[model samples]
Target: MNITKNKFILLFLCLILLLIASFFLALSYGNAQIPLDSIADIVINHLVYGIKSNDENGALYDIIWLLRMPRIILAICVGAGLSVCGVVMQAIVKNPLADPYILGISSGASLGATAAVLLGIGSTLGENFIGISAFMGALGISFLVLFIANLGGPANSVKLLLAGMALSAICSAFSSFIVYFANNMEGIQTITYWLMGSLAGANWPLLSKLVPLILICIFLLWSQAKILNLMLLGDDTAITLGYNLQIYRQSYLLITSLMIGTIVYASGVLGFVGLLIPHLVRMLIGTDHKYLIPVSALIGASFLIVCDLCCRIILPRAELPIGLLISLIGAPTFIYMMIRKTYSFGSK
Candidate 1:
């Protein structure tokens, strides 16, 4: 017993070290390729002496502290948030394919942001119009999906999945229709990037709110680990064990939708983290939510930070969209997982 416990402790400690290493490594590389020591100096000097280093080297400091830092941090939050949400959503629906974005939330966000950009409906919201509109769209679509799923009778996992797909299709159609009619080249470019996802919007002002929301959601989801585990055992079995998923499912769905919506508003649509990260963690640590939640979150954070770094360096003068890169990687991994019978999505 002690040996197993000790092994998990050691594993987690090592994971923390890995996360720190990844953070520093991400900070060091970008278009300019800043050095590790410079990265450390910028953070340490600013944090300790309460001074902003400005001069010849100040430009590097600004790039790291202002640009790279916030984006990387946003990547971590979105990655961790989406990964944890994926784990719970999969458990809620008892389907391995489930993810935060699999529902209509991300599409809804995209639609809202696209409308704001192209149609100028929410342009009056000020600088954060896109984000504000996206969040509203996400929340509204989530409620719509839930309401639709419950229209005929009690909502089930299958119903939720189906309803999400229906709304997602509807939202996608509207987005396409809007673009098709707009005929503005510059507007099209902005909408394209927003749909593809970018962390370029990261900054302290937004990060301040994003970080706390992610932390709180991760903590809340982690606390529900036991309930999540029960959920995987099927509705009948969960009820027999003194738990009711019907009640808990909506609560979890609502919470996850909020987290995903915030992420989309902050970072745009980042796919596959939710779908890919949890599955990879399950392969490493099995299906136990207690272990799955945190491990998946950490790995997801590392995964996105690395992906964001790749996007920056992969192209010389231009950067790639994060959503595009993730889809490129996620699709292959998903195919491999589905082909392998060993993992079996969930317990038989």
Candidate 2:
């Protein structure tokens, strides 16, 4: 037992180091390509002595602190948040294939963002009206799914899945209808880019609000590790062990919705991070939630930081949408995992 505990501790330390390395790597590379030593100097100087940049290094300072820093931080938060939510969602439904967006939240968020951009909905809600609208839509659809699932009786995994699918379809149809009739090509283009997801809009103000929320949600979910593990044993088995899982399932779903909604608001819809990271971590460390949650979070954060860096460097002048890149990578990797016969979900 001591050996196992020590192994986990070592693994965590390695992942944390990897995450820190990825963060610095991302900071060093961009369109301008700042040097690592300079990047470290600027960051440390500002953090320690409350110094802004001098006139000599003004451009580099703005590029590092103003643009890349917030974007990279947002990427880490979105990545970690999505991955942790994936862990909880899979446990909630007791399905290996489940992801954070399986419950129609993504579609709902898309619909809301679409309405905000094209139809000028929620224009009165301040500068972040689009994101606010998206959050509202995501949270609303999640509750709607819960309501639909509980129509006949207590909600179960199967019922929740079906309700989510039904609502997802409906939301997609609505979004398409709005897009088709809007007749505004510029708005359509903006919506298209938004749906594909980008970290370009990331700023310190947004990060100030989003980072804390994501970290809190991740911590709360991590604290529920034991309950999450029990969820894998099926509801009846959990009941036999003197724990009712229904309330826990609903609670987890709600928390995951909030986290994912916040992510959508920040980075638009990032696919596959949530779906991919948790499974990848589970394969490495087994299905123990205590180990699974933090490991997956760290790996996911590093994964996105690297991916976001790729997005910046892939094209000479333009950046690729992160959602498209992730999908391209995640789908093929997932297919390969499925074909690998030795790799079973939730197996030690």
| lDDT for each candidate structure | 0.86, 0.89
Candidate 1: stretches off by over 4 Å: 1-4
What are the models' TM-scores? 0.95, 0.97
> After superposing candidate 2, which stretches have Cα over 4 Å from the reference?
1-3, 341-348
Give the range of the ten consecutive residues with the poorest summed lDDT in model 2.
Answer: 339-348
Q: Residue 57 deviation, candidate 1, in Å?
A: 3.1
lDDT of each residue in 1-348, candidate 2, tens digit only? 112667889999999999999998999997888999899889988999888899877888899999999999999999999999999988887788889889899999999999999999999998889888998999999999999998989998888988998999999999999999998999999889989999999999899999999999999999999998888878877888999887888998999999999999888988888888987876677788888899999999999999999999999999999999999999999887767634445322
Across 47-120, the per-residue lDDT of candidate 1 in tens digits comes to 99876867857898788888888988998998899999999989878888888877788889989988999999
- Say which candidate scores most in TM-score: 2
